[model samples]
Target: MHNEVRSVDGGSSLVQAQYIGTVNQQLPGPERVVPHETPRALRRLVGRNEQIEACLADQRVPLVVFDGLTGVGRRALARYVAEQVKDRYPGGAYYTDYATHTVDGESVISAALRSLLRRDGVRDEVMPAEPGLASLWRRRSSGAAAVLLLENVTESEQFLQLMPGGRDWLVLVAGRVESRLEVREVGGETIPVEPLDDEQAAELFRELSGLDADPDDPVVAEILGYCGGLPLALRNAATLVVVGRCPSLPELAARLRRSRAELMRSDRGPNKGNPVFEATYQEATEPAQRAYRLLGAYPAIDFTPPVFDLLIGLDEATSRDILAELVLLKVLQEEHGRYSMHPLVHDHAASLSGLDDEETHEALARVVRGFRNAAYYADAAMIGVERYRVADAPEIADPFSGDRRANGLAWFEENRRALHELLPVAEKIGLVDEIWQIAESLAAYYFDRKRQADSLSSLRHGIKAAEEAGNRAAEARLRSLASRPLTDLEQFEQAGDFVRRSIELADQDGHLVLRASVREFAGRYHDLTDQPELAQQRYRESIELNEAAGEARGEALSRMFLGQSLGDAEGLRELETAHRAFGELGDSRSAARALLITGQVRVRTGLPGGVDALTAAAEAFQTSGATFYEAQAREALHGALVVENPVEARSHLDRAIQLYRELGSPRAEKLASENDGGLDGAES
Candidate 1:
């Protein structure tokens, strides 16, 4: 019996069996091969008209390969061509990314086949195994006129495995220029996709930037030249302009000229830099090549110039020159004076056979140590010197020299992701001391920013490392720090347990400041759990311990908490004293917290000047990057003003909602829901 094929909507084909002879058995037709939708193409194609026309010039060619340097827009061009000719193949256009789908350098042809078959109504249990996938695919797709767009194809064999057996089928492959020879042997026509021309690059930049300027303008010309006619570079440059990073064309041009590196490096979409970067690295200067290899092994996502110098073991000027050269080569990307490699480029650089194991390990160790030292300095500058800190601040030149507190907090905020990335790397290399110490340094920043989840995760890791190294003081500090995030996350039982353990550890270790800190956390846990009397007792104990240890900051902080628990005239007096002490100690952030609590209590009790106090506190928190507290102050101000001035109250609520949303706080949604349908019709 033979089957007659019928095309259906959505690129599926049905079959009807035609039986002959005496036997009257009707066999089921082949399963419908439901075509996967083609990958989304760029909203607009730029400077690929010639390539598109060539690909479509001969409709009879079954295979077409668009090969070029990475980020030259090969994938985008192929996607555009496939979309344009989609109607020619009724079986529909199917798409898959080979780079994403492959496993351990082997093409996962079975996954591709299974995806196609499953979508075509094939049941999972009835599906064929790996060896049978290609046979089934060919059998099912025999008469189906379809288009296949295989992106980032690395080998010709991958193409052969997925190729349909029909003469009418068209396969469009996109990969690096090196893949052209292998694909050509399989009758695939190679189309070399070059960088955009000057005019096209200029148009793309103008379109993306939403800027209207003469093409001959000096700044515009400088940008175009720096982009080197690459669409990826042009898009990123335009992004920098649109985001107000450079503010104007001239500023962007000057930045480009000064750094000789693309400021805005994006790894979005199919812009992998590995293929072209490998060749670029091979041709770069020895110093630039060494920088690339070492940087690839660097754990952090990005680094400043000083850190770069340390990592490369070079002097300041020499390292800067090497960085400029690598940036000019497009191997390293620099953004706002910090240098980093694209993840794909980093992977390639790391894979290169340059540094031996010991050299790489030592280089990475130096970078980690540099970060640790800087973190300790920033921590001290931002929060004052905490006696509970296990690691001493190394006697290095201070990185944050001016406006120490502001700059320290700013540095932590800027490198937060890099700091988080370094933890596992440090742990892997047995830098246990560094791991706990870095986590300890980040605790205050984390708490002020309301990154409770991150705080909890980092503290847990630090606690583990401290315990592993048998460092009781570090373990005690980390455990006490864990309570804050746990309490904020509403894991009250866990928070209380951590507080108890921390108190015990501090006593056993015989550290007065550590014991004071743990006592304050215990008081916080009690307050959160609504045991005001017990909370006050813990706070009083903490105050005595801090005073005994001559730690005025800890004593003042505990007094602030004690005042909050009191919630009366005496409580107000305590808050006033704590605020004054913090101001005298030059700890403005802690002063602001004390003022915030006082304002909150006054607002709740309908006291005068509550709004004024909240407004001042909010401003301070905003200035200090204490985003969570700022939101709290805003919420308090809204509550205080809602009855008397609904319009102003709504404004405060709006700002609070925005800040909470930015911080990923659930309070954002809660406030939004509570205020929904126009707060007292004031919004209308």
Candidate 2:
């Protein structure tokens, strides 16, 4: 009887005994674990009714593979089908885009598994390592009724890694037609999503363009033929007409014909290039054309207007106007004020840009510089200027001027995906200094967001970049910071090596602040490994070096760690001193951290006022947007109140669980599991 069912009222109850001849058993709860929301289907989906009906009718099939060419609406069809059938699966509906998750052509299965488990309330602390993730996913997903929508799947192996070990699950996979056979072998029934028919294409175009022209018009017919019935192409052609890019349908048709001729001559085959995209592109002004070409060189999937300006070396208003024009022409897509090009359009733009290697390099260099500078400034604003930043903040107009902290953090959040995508591009373009500096600037934000995997990846790139440039100080700083993520991931051996290398480099460089930072990192590594004496010794060394180097912030941080490791009255005093120092230095985030540590020690030691300290720390963390630390403070408050104040303790525990859940932290599961029985008892 591993069948524990949670009732709708949120209570565990055994099944009726009479059904099993007086044998009492609990049934598993119907858990809804929709990790990623299925993308909404197109409102004006003109001609997929048959495919949708077929998919909905086949309730017996475990896997359905929707295979088609790029931009043929495979994902749209899959999404529509999943939305229709999701209610049938009580467990949950899950969605993942393989294009965004893959690295070097292989799926990062472990990351996907972690996402699944975390959404299922599995805490990171108790979750098994990468080697055991796939088996664990199968075990946990066994017998669960669910729907999984996997988009851009390259091969069958990626599907196998995510396949649920349940008979009642429906997995909808969308990929290119070439990937259909391998998936078919894995019990996936193929459903080919083809291009629209002429009538359907006309309907969709009319819907998108809002035009009153007859479908039988020769120019309209010519334009539709040039589009080849591809939904994306149709949309582009229709958008051009709607935006008044041409005075009449005949003019648009003539433009498309001319562009088609140019494309056929330049491309490998007549059908190889999209004439709709070419015509729309050709209609753009000179600045917009240059912007489109340079944008293709931008490695990120999406970017803001400021980033576009940086890439093209234009004023903000001019860049935004260009983006608006492209968006109107459907050459670029704009969502939430972020502009992106479709894969086909991006390829066409890149191929025809005619930018020499030097121009490409220069354009990329500008982008890297912009990112590096913005990130460094944002980091300083968020964390304060006391921390040793190896990169110099140039005296430029601050993009995040008013309310620097909030704006800076918001900018980072908005651009996080693009920033991550830019790292490798920077490396490839030989922007070595920018690579390491961007990594360093992003370190605090990454840590706060609990993006350990991303942090480690960027740090590795930064390390290589630093080494290539033969910059010991930068390498040492990056290595020191790298230890944080490695330690967090429980890779102590690797963390220790990074710390050791950082220390060696710091010593050779003879920069006291750098030396102190690396020593502090060493102490953190030792503390995580439970080497208390060694940790204390390293912290003390760090404190002395920081004092000598006149780095007050570094000294305060080391003191806070020293106090936490010591876990005694003297440690409490040290924490208090560090908290005061941080307050005086205007580092509220660090002060809150110090208070959190102090509160935790007090709670563990059964000291008075521990609840008060933890409450204050939680409030500070909440206000400062330090979500991870806020969760910790809440958990600590629960610990301090669970005995005498069970009611309040449960409330705190619930809040902590919610915070951790929002963070996708593994601790959520552990905390929920530990408090489940007690909270139920408290409620009764």
Candidate 3:
């Protein structure tokens, strides 16, 4: 049932029809589909061996411009080099295609400004609507240390604007037209990609089409000559040959000449192929053209199902068919369920669309906002936000302004990866308010699930973006957000610095919510660093702030943490206070967590009620959807039960141990194991 359509043979003069294996044969489905766009390894592409040696030997290339003609594969070579020397540019990595030098033929700078914005992934800062876009682009790229690929550029101003930025950035410009671009701040050597010599052209043809295709044949030489050593031309020719359309190279040359004429006469009929692209693009329907241009608006390599609905105005089947056709024509590449235009093809399509820059921006913004909306709902469920639904609702939930605390915890777990992906786009678009909301939602998931790596990555980036955007509330939240993982990793000094920053930001912004959150996180950090008195002081302060803000849930959480820390500090009186606060919040999971900590406190003091508290907590946690807490609570209850009731103790301990083992939690297992051994020893 494989639905793969292989290229037609080069030897055939006629366009070889697609082979339908059998009329009754089933179609290839999702299970049979192979992955399409696995990023090729860096070693596989060109010009990188020298760059690698230079980077490794610490030689300075201050600026190396890889400049060339359109579709000459210069950008690909640059990308390969970037991949190779990524370690050298550790500050960051930036890629931009400068192909669209005309936004309604306004200014090359405006076109480049849009690309630069796309490159940095910067959003949310108030920017001028139009005209002076280049000034803004120049300002943003000047400071970063990264690599910039200036693709398909024409004017010197594009390079001049970017020259002031990216101290360590390597700028590679690719296109048919060169700017003779020069800068005073940095001297760069240009590596011009000349038209391939006959030998190289022949080699390219052989690689694309095979050696079996007669090299001595005049037809082969004819097609190669027509292509004029252009890599793009060679690629398209090879595709035609594989489909068995132009059997002989001479025939390809003849057909291409005919295509050129047809393209020139396009005003005569309307559907004739583009003169520049030859006749290949003319074969596409208007709907396909619309789809091609619309798909280019999404920044990410992949698109969700909803993208088809939003961007292209066709039904799913029709859109998928058009997309598949474009991929066949080599204008688009399909990967998973998503599609992307080759960067050059993307430029061509954009130029053809006639849509102005503002229109393009508006369309792109809508798509990104839609993506954010979907991911937000998913994340909301994972963090115990219950009110948000998967379908159409009256109001869109705002992570920052909305009552996110009211949503049930499930939102965070369901949309964790989606939320993670949304972070960069959210920041780039200057959605500062959204960034803060995401940080809060993610904080709960990161701590509860122990996703330390992701927590650090997401929070740190958000913090920087928030600070840059001057969103005081977001800055304050991220200050606390950055502390948790460092504390977990035993980086105490760094953890304390983050907490202090959070406090400073909160105080400057006068955000009581952020202030309270920081106080609680500081308590956690202090306890991790073995400063119990400081931890106790921070915990009480967090509780007081939450109470003053009238934030019942925050107050409850702070009370729970205070009790746990004090209980760990061997203060039993705080357990009753923690229990009361948690009960007020009506959070079964937190209440259960409180009970487990209380039981541990009681166990240290040899209190008679330890087993009862643990048993009750285990029951509550089991229904709260967390396997880890349930197992721990059960183990605690089993330990207390072991001293008085062996049968009941063994029953609970066995299940607890099995559950803990399944969850890969060694601490919970140890507790269950010790209780089991004690009961068995008592019986013996």
Candidate 4:
């Protein structure tokens, strides 16, 4: 979640209005095995119910333009609205801030398309031109459903190009407007978000500051006057009182008066924080100020305590404590253990911290180092065929420790968006090495989620970086990594070419581990292309090379894939051996794959434990967050059960088809076609 401070709407009805919310949900490329909770619920949205209800009522409208003053809760309103109706968009509700950073050269349409395609699980390498990406979004969304909250869009032309070209999906565009003209030009119904009325402001202050003052109290009115009733300033004023910087609300009000008196017209302009941020900044403790400014350098999204540790280079305990203090001050909001700063607050902090370029640069380096290490370790845990492992990196605390819901796969899924955002940030600072490392580390998650496009995108970056760094071994490995996704995408010729190039590079560099790994992809391409003989030969060569390199995981997987594609008694022997290797290595996904293949072979031989083996494989895949593989295991079971138990087989096939369709895999067509109008061919 980008910003999480929604204000009360005082129950004003909307003729037409749309609010922008930042996207916080990760793709299945991010969702992983299961979601542990619902979207974070609102604490209290004052003065915003009518606007929300009106937007919900006008479902056919498809687009709503939320025009409001800065700090008046536009992002908050959008977030509130998304939470209210997310169920309607089964594809998921997403938030993105297209507030255009300095080096973001893409057109507004390109940015919008990127957001939409990313939501649809299309990674950047496969990302098409604007029109085509939008077309892909239209086709995908029309069939399923989606919601996008686009924040910081300044013109009608921006959102106009992003409209679904149909009415099935909903988009809310939020921005500050000098007039309703832009909103009118976009043809969206406009919802103007006003500041809180007296009653709401009083309630908000008491809630935030622990103040007992009533609505009619002179002190309360005086404070609200300086805040202009904007939730941003009002909350900052209340924070001053709550944090003991002011002895009372009256003192806070007086301080605000002095700050506004000192402000130049330029400093008090509309884009400004109305002198409130200045007063709050002046009053905050030194540590709090430093934490706030450092927080601005973090990504524009929800983050965890460990991220703070990365941002400020503080120990985890101190970093977490600082964040907790900010939460109490209403400068940050905590939801289900993740904390987010309102954009206005982040902007305010960012504006003040322009004096420390060197420290800021080092802080950013810490962030890169942290992400690179996390991605490396997380990938290691998820997949076992280790071509390499990052050695001797600093031990960083797991950011997802607060939730207790993550293993390797779940961790990758959770941080997918954050990692994506960090790629550009690393590039901007010339952390070229970190950029490719992070991208390569995330390859396993993208592969399992069937996000071939995303995998290819990351691999391309790694390849470019390796070439630039003149690291032939890394270039070969990246080429091998790049081909796996191409194989998945069924671009067999393209995949094989990469494999061939990788082999040449590995041979030139005498990289044995690299050669072994690239050969596995080569074998897979042959296997997928129905040349089982060629696949078997390639797998044998891979196994020989891996054995020479002493890579147990690679050797085991080569045997598993070769045996599975062969479908003979000898194959079963190989699978059993591979399964034992994976299980002993604690690599659950590969273990599951081996078991699934062995189970199918067992069923062919009329063995009693065929279903049991497949069952265990499914369970393993589920626990490890290999959802697509889980579905594949289920499909194999369906095939095995078709002869002995038609009813069970139908159920299994139904589930497999459902998952395949959801993932948009071509396997769904084959599975559905094989079912052929209700299992009419079942029985021996």
Candidate 5:
């Protein structure tokens, strides 16, 4: 079922609507285009063509300020020039308009950035602080020739927060003429946009009016003269004539003559801009206008037609048709079927909508539910049911279809970025179960990609959501999932807390399988924290529970972990059994981990088969794509082989160090520690 309730034509609370705007361009989503906030191409720029060409060619100054008195063509020139040079910037030429500037520096930067990230499908959360968010954006677009046109900026301080760290990045700031002094102080080239001369004014008037051989037309000349050679006023005057509301340019010129002083005053920009928009809007059909206002209520910068349907309570085809009309009217811009209205247009439409706070929240609530459903299906598909499985999960309409035709992993691969952005909304709306389920389900995908921080973040969100929902099982599972990353991070204190909480919850639940599953994490925490004896005991208890429940995977995991703590003869015995169990169960990764542990124990005991065991283990890790641990296993082999086959040992050392460096591990230090120390000397 399509997610909708209220029609764009009228009011219906969105909360009652079940909206799921899923499926779009390539899965994880297409790369973001820089916001060419104005028209993409301009044939002529009046007198500003030379200045625009100069700005386009300049390479030395990374920042350029287009300074002008308020009705001059500062914005038009910057946008025109950026489009000309956009191909040089593969990262994109996005705009950050500041005409709505309230003089709050922090809010200005945050709001603009929030807009861009949403355009990038980073919907859930962005970095909380200005510097951090700026740094994140710099990192995402690092080394790319990206351009940012900051329009109507009143203060240089506002630009500082959003400065891209890249030395070669282009920042074009358009503001009042006086702001040029500060802009110039910051290594920015200042281009002052003076009023257009008669020739330039005639060219602009001709372009706006689409007239041939008419630059010197007496009536057009008279009207253009009243515009004070300002492009905005000239364009506004021309648009009035083109829409056929006026009989002739001469009549409009006479009306402008009556209010000539008032219209040509310092505030002419607003007087020209607003009425042009209002007149254009007055001619739009009801559906297009309603779709315009309805979309203005959306918090995100860009959205697809499916989302538009959900928001406006219109069917997909009708919604898309209306969206096309708005795009035609230039109230919105559409690229590859996604729609984004200019900020100024959005603000105007939003003011006219008269939708109350309740309606806005209701609209957003539907979005949250839709997103929650997508996450739930994405979770199940990416991670499968065996790990941190949930029951009674509501499925969204599967736009991706069946498992064979669909790809669970690809969904996460493509959609994870969007999902991460939506998490904050989940928290805001209190989708408690959905939050934890989505988080816990992401473990397999996050871990496999070596995204430890993302895994830890999901777990943190899951823990809070589970606690809020009073879901003991979810809390236990989420905490267990958290322990692995904490251990990897060497954050022993937190890992210990996570395991202990998980164990307590499992014990209270009194489910043997759950307890067995969770105790493996307890054992892992003990091993990571260097409490080997305690680890062995926890593993034994877990093994006993798994054995009784006939859970072969659980038994094998507990035994493998126990072997690392036991060492020597007992270690060999436990590891051999675990390896056999894993192989029998067709779990290649688990079997490889067991073999690696076994190889370490064998080398310490001076076993003849140690080299062979370590070699096999390293190869398994390589096949399994566990690169870092494979390096460590190679280091262990090098330690054992150095006493005999020194050449092979040196070869192993080189490869291990390379893997360490690639994985960003302490390469030389880890190799030195393992090669010199080996495993423990017979562990008493």
Candidate 6:
């Protein structure tokens, strides 16, 4: 009487039914449990020679579960073993699909009773309504050995409930989800069915379709490799060979290659029962097919719900549901809250989405734009330098509002791999602006982490893209970003080369800001190489251009560097101007640097003492994670403290000397050592 079936959590089930019958009538035909269909000819198939021998061994629970990915022939092997073990069960064998059954935790007892009663040839007239179905099913199976074939089961709840209280019956459960099932005593056994080994695959291939020679033969191996160790693919590829459609082994390989190639071109195709993957896709519904195709729109392997919602035109819940279905079908995979499809399947999905070359480019462009925007917002927050900015910006609906840094960092980290792969494609498609924008956005993350190589590679590609696009302004800007990493790597000559090109490009394009910025880098290069005169000249030029262009911030930076070249006292003269300009731009770090510079000048001239100025500088540098500058300030502070007390002086001097030496700044280290020696001499 109780046949109303529903999912335990009110979620949609693949099948649902509500019963209205009150008599508890034992229906004869339709209500009986339907057995899983097994391929007929595979029952006594040759070449499971080892498995047949294994099943003949004495074991209490002689059941073996065959499990594999979609289209790998788990059912075929299971049926073959079932046929061989038929003589062991005196009461005959029963085949049923536990996968499609909706028997709840409470109803499993009844469902098992009905299934057992139907097999026991008991009529409804003698069966009682009460004492429950579990009691009735157990009584019917009394004093007999029963064998059951349970197919496509994913959960173990139903199986555990129906397992005969005694150990007389042998039960075999097969499905793709074996990870959830745990076996215990009463002669527990577990066997995982994997793709056939190459040799076994070859044997199955020859025995089933007459492709007999050594499979290790180069040509045969080539064909088997195309099958991807799946029995269904091998069977289909063999069928193609036997029918003279693709006769030679090489031709069959070609056919599979062609099939895969085509799978990548369209989203849907005839499941030819041969190419394994095509047949699997043929089994999906329209919604599942759409889900499969839409997954291709996500270029990164770890795609979140927000991205899927944005690009796939589906709501969060709907997308998750569809993705779940695809996961069950082996068309998609869910890992750590993100989704991914296999490369082969991804290509097919991309092809089938009806996107032309131009549209694909456009879609990729949108994704890149979103990524770049996130990167830009992160960079703008971290550093005040606005390397690149797009006009007519879209509104940002940030999900992780409380912590923008962590969220942006995570997004960049997740997509970093995919972004690297997409760079070449963007360049090939002539999206130069996009190329530079993405690089510029990631610059802060790379620079802050001291990933010199990554920064250089990104900027180099960005510069190349800009040059190819004939964008002189962008080229100049990219070259400036590129120079920092080159300098870090001590490729001074290359760094200087980029600075020169940026200057030329900026001047040619009349991009005054870029021209001013490039000149600042040139000045830095000159200073690093000990060409003070040349450094002063470049800094002066940058100052003049920045002033003329009304870029107060740029003007301030150039003048600050110029003052530093002149010496500590002179550097303080320009600090107030630099501070005012940086303040106007709301750049806390630059303003802080200017203040620190002013403090250093005061200390050098014995006005406020070097310790005070250096302490302020250190604090600013620490706040910004400016390790290099912070170390420099610490070194200066150590020098100032050298004269205060001998013990403290030696401690500061020794530490400063070591840090400078570790940084590979010989000039800085030599000065620190000189101070240390002077302190030692005085102390002695």
Cα lDDT tens digits for candidate 1, 535-560: 89999999999999999988998899
Count clashing residue pairs per candidate.
0, 3, 41, 14, 5, 2
Model 6, span 468-518: residue lDDT tens: 877777778778777888887899888988888888888888767777788
Across 263-322, the per-residue lDDT of candidate 3 in tens digits comes to 122222243344443344565677766666665544443455556565564577886777
| lDDT comparing candidate 3 with the true structure | 0.59
In candidate 6, stretches whose alpha carbon ends up further than 4 angstroms from where it belongs are 1-280, 290-299, 314-317, 330-337, 340-359, 384-411, 563-567, 575-585, 594-614, 617-684
| Candidate 1 clash pair list | none
Q: Is candidate 1 or candidate 6 better by TM-score?
A: 1
Candidate 5: where are CA atoms >4 Å away?
1-268, 271-384, 388-410, 610-684
lDDT for position 188 in model 1: 72
Scored by Cα lDDT, where does model 5 land? 0.69
- Give the alpha-carbon lDDT of every model: 0.78, 0.78, 0.59, 0.70, 0.69, 0.63
Model 3 misplaced regions, further than 4 Å: 1-303, 307-364, 374-415, 425-433, 568-572, 634-684
Q: In model 1, which range of ten residues has the least summed lDDT?
A: 675-684
- Among these predictions, the greatest TM-score belongs to 2
lDDT of 2 by residue, 1-684 (tens): 334444555565655433334553444444644544777766646898888888889557888888655566777788888888888887778888764664554337777778777777677767787778888888877866888898866556667788888878888988643345665676768887767887888888888787755668877888777766667677667656777886577877888876643322212224344443565566578888888888777777578777888888878877778777776555666678777765556656766654357777788788888888888888877776666888888667666677667777787888777888889888777888889999998888888778899889999999999999999999999999999999888998989999999999999989999999999989988888879899899999999999998999999999999999898899999999999999999888788888888877887777877778888988998897777888888877787778888899899889889998988887799888878422110000
Poorest lDDT segment (10 consecutive residues) of candidate 2: 675-684
Candidate rank order under TM-score: 2, 1, 6, 4, 5, 3
Clashing pairs in 5: 28-414, 35-94, 123-421, 124-421, 124-422
Candidate 5, residues 1-684, lDDT tens digits: the string is 455455554564554535546644433645555554534546667787679778867475778877654457777787777777777776677777764533555577677766656665564433346556666666665656678777766556657666776777788776643345666676788786767877778777777776541547887777766776767777666666677755477677787766543332233344443433454466478877766666666655567666677767767788777876665455665677566654345545666554355555566556656656665666555444343363346654654446511366566665566556556666775677777877876776676555678889988998999999998988898898899888888888888888999999988877787888888878877876788788888999999999898888889888887887887688889889999998998777678778788888888877767778888988987865667568777788778888788888888888788786776655557665665524442110
> Taking the tens digit of each residue's C-alpha lDDT, what string does model 4 give over 365-418?
887888788887777666542536322343765443332324666787778888
Any runs in candidate 2 off by more than 4 Å, and if so which?
A: 1-276, 353-356, 676-684
lDDT of 5 at 261: 34
**Candidates 1 and 3: which is better by TM-score?**
1
Q: In model 5, which range of ten residues has the least summed lDDT?
A: 675-684
